[model samples]
Target: MLQQSARDFLNRQAPVKHLRSLRDAGGSKGFSREVWAEMSALGWPAMAIPEEYDGLGFGFTGMGIVLQETGRTLTPCPLLSSAMMAAAAIVHAGDDAQKSTLLPGIASGEALVTLAFDEHTHHRPGQVAATAKRTAGGFCISGHKRFVLDGAMSDQLIVSARTDDRVPDGRGISLFIVPATASGITITPCQVLDTHVLADITLDDVRLPAAALLGAENEGLAILEYALDAGRIGQSAELLGVALEAFERSIAYLKERKQFGVPIGSFQALQHRAAVLFGELELCKSLVLNALHRLDSDANEIAATASMTKAKVVETASKATAEAIQWHGGIGMTDDFDIGFFYKRARILETMLGDRYFHLDRFARQHGY
Candidate 1:
């Protein structure tokens, strides 16, 4: 089903050109509402939600499969930012009433929600300093968040704020559902390496009702961590797809490009490079699939596995994109070539969520090293 979905999208959207057009059109959502409605009609956004919430109940594994396909084409969809990651936040921590009210629209893709967690230059979850002080009717949020995916386009923002005196430990952190059109909100558009649009959001005395809070007060770190773990697995799957696409393109170029009246692939050095890339791709695939399975089965070492998977996928995908460019030689360096597009996207994905350094450190700490 996943592969078919990808094939269907490619057939309809014309692959990389479709994404290029989205960028050219100055898309705020990085996607069209019509396409989003089509995806919703296909029941894709609901794949991660539980069956009780009118979802397919396929869990993270299903989400991983869909993301892999999206990554292959570099589809400008919010499945990762809104559906998989932010929806996980709601599904895992939201109260029954909250779940019933919020998730149905999310599942149907009628509502687009995004996470606003990073408040600083780094991707540290524990560095949340955005204050949510008690007010008359509810609370007032005040601070800034950078690199919020789909922040400007999403209908609802799942914001993380400091709710207590705890600092750098994530204990005082809390998540809230704030309207994107709220009075004190400002969204500044920012572009990343891949030409993907991110929003820098500033909350200046943004007031919300008491019922806007999701999960328990001053105890949101655990919920955030749960959602992050699921996101890491989805990211790994997407990176795996990226690596595979780049590697396949490189192999094709090698077979087609000729030197000395022979295909470049006939050369021993080029053949060796292809073999190494193939091995790494296989290893990445194994790790990604294993992590997805571990999460699906509720494994005890989920944190460690997730970190390991994320770090490996970043390394492998980076290497694959670099090799693809190198093998393509001069043509790959030009803007006309699609390989450059993949390379830029790989570079952006490298530091998204967390970089190699961050995940490696997290892996070490998870193992008590």
Candidate 2:
């Protein structure tokens, strides 16, 4: 299913020319509405949601398969935001009312959503700069959230903020759902290494009613924990896409590009590196699939497995992309080619949820090491 989707997309939207066109607009950061339409038409948004809610109702494994193809093409759509981050949050933490209202729209692609939880403080939702102070009607939000994925384009924004400062940090956080066009909200686009659009969102006395609060007030971090596991899995899934692509490119170059009458691929040292990269990719893939299966089955080891998968996928994929570029020589550096794009995208995807080091520590702690 994954390869077929990728093959179809390759023939249609992900050809070298199509990717180049997105690159020409700007490298790395792009959100193409037309391309988004193609993805929507393909029913990707519905894959992980329940069929009763008008979704495909498949598990993360199915979504991973589709997203592998998405990563292969590197289409500038909001897979993490629309399909995983925001969607999974709804699925895992939302109430029946919230599900009935939000899930259908999300699955159908009429609404685009993204989560904004980062406040520049390291690893604590309790470190929220944004605060929701109680008002007569409901709650008012104030402060900035940086590096929100696809912030400018998403139809709805799910925000995490502190409701109290006296408690331990993550304990006082709360999640809220607000509209993009809501009064007192500003989404400013930030230029970063990847051409992927990121936003600095400022909510100046943005009022959200009682119903806007997701789960319970001042207990959002627990809900965030659920999102984090799913988010890490999603990120791993994305890296798996880059790893496969990088390996394929390395192989192709070795077979064709010549050195002294023989293909450079014939070089012993180069062949060894390709073998290592392929092995790393396979090992990384095993962990992610294990994590995904554990989560879908509600297994006891899901959390620890997620940390394991996150560390391996990010680390191995970084090495994979770098090797692909180095072996391809200078052509990999050019904007006209996909290797550099894959490299940059791999780097961007690597740091999203938890870096390898972060997961390494978490994995050890969870295992009582």
TM-score of each: 0.96, 0.94
| Model 2 TM-score on a 0 to 1 scale | 0.94
Error of 2 at 306 (Å): 1.9
Give per-residue lDDT, candidate 2, residue 244.
87
Candidate 2 per-residue lDDT, tens place, 1-369, comes to 655865687558755456567656764446677777777788888878888888987877777776666677666678668777788888877888888899888887878888888778344444687889988888999988888888888889999988887887568889998898999998888755656788889999999888888888888887776777777887788788878877897899999999799999999999999988888888987887777777677833567888888889988989988989899998888876778878887877777666788889989989899
Candidate achieving the largest lDDT: 1
RMSD of 2: 2.0
**Alpha carbon lDDT of residue 278, candidate 1?**
90
| Candidate 1 runs further than 4 Å off | 166-168, 299-301
lDDT values, one for every candidate: 0.85, 0.80
